[model samples]
Target: MRGDSWTESYLRSDIMRESVIYQAILEEGELSAKLTSIPRLLVLGLTREQIAQALDLEIEQVPQVIEGQN
Candidate 1:
């Protein structure tokens, strides 16, 4: 197959989604999004414990995320 066709086939949404690299990227993006939301949740009156539980993050990780945002 030509390079363009091969690349296109490999990058198709369904095929890309099945790749281990793609899955890892997706998970990282999800975790980033969750971490990014922590400060907002705090401003809305959620404690570190509540945010950790609601976001399914470790309690220790909550403070770390907050610190990183500073």
Candidate 2:
């Protein structure tokens, strides 16, 4: 009975950890998409500050993001 309880606890902990990692992965993907779209938004008449605000990024980070895309 004790071993079964330990196994269950371990499984739950592992599942929780995996869930956190999965969330991080999804956030990274969303950020990547945002970064890629910055240039397109700029070409479409959005100013750098506006793009940064819309994407929830720092205005200073905009150039770096564009550089990375290039």
Model 2 clash pairs are none
Candidate 2 segments exceeding 4 Å error: none
Error of 1 at 38 (Å): 0.3
lDDT of candidate 2 over 7-47, digit per residue (tens): 99999999999999999999999998988889999899998
lDDT of model 1, residue 37: 94
- Candidate models: Cα lDDT each: 0.90, 0.92
TM-score of each: 0.72, 0.86
Model 1, residue 7: displacement in angstroms?
17
TM-score of predicted structure 2: 0.86
Which residue pairs clash in candidate 1?
none
Candidate with best TM-score: 2
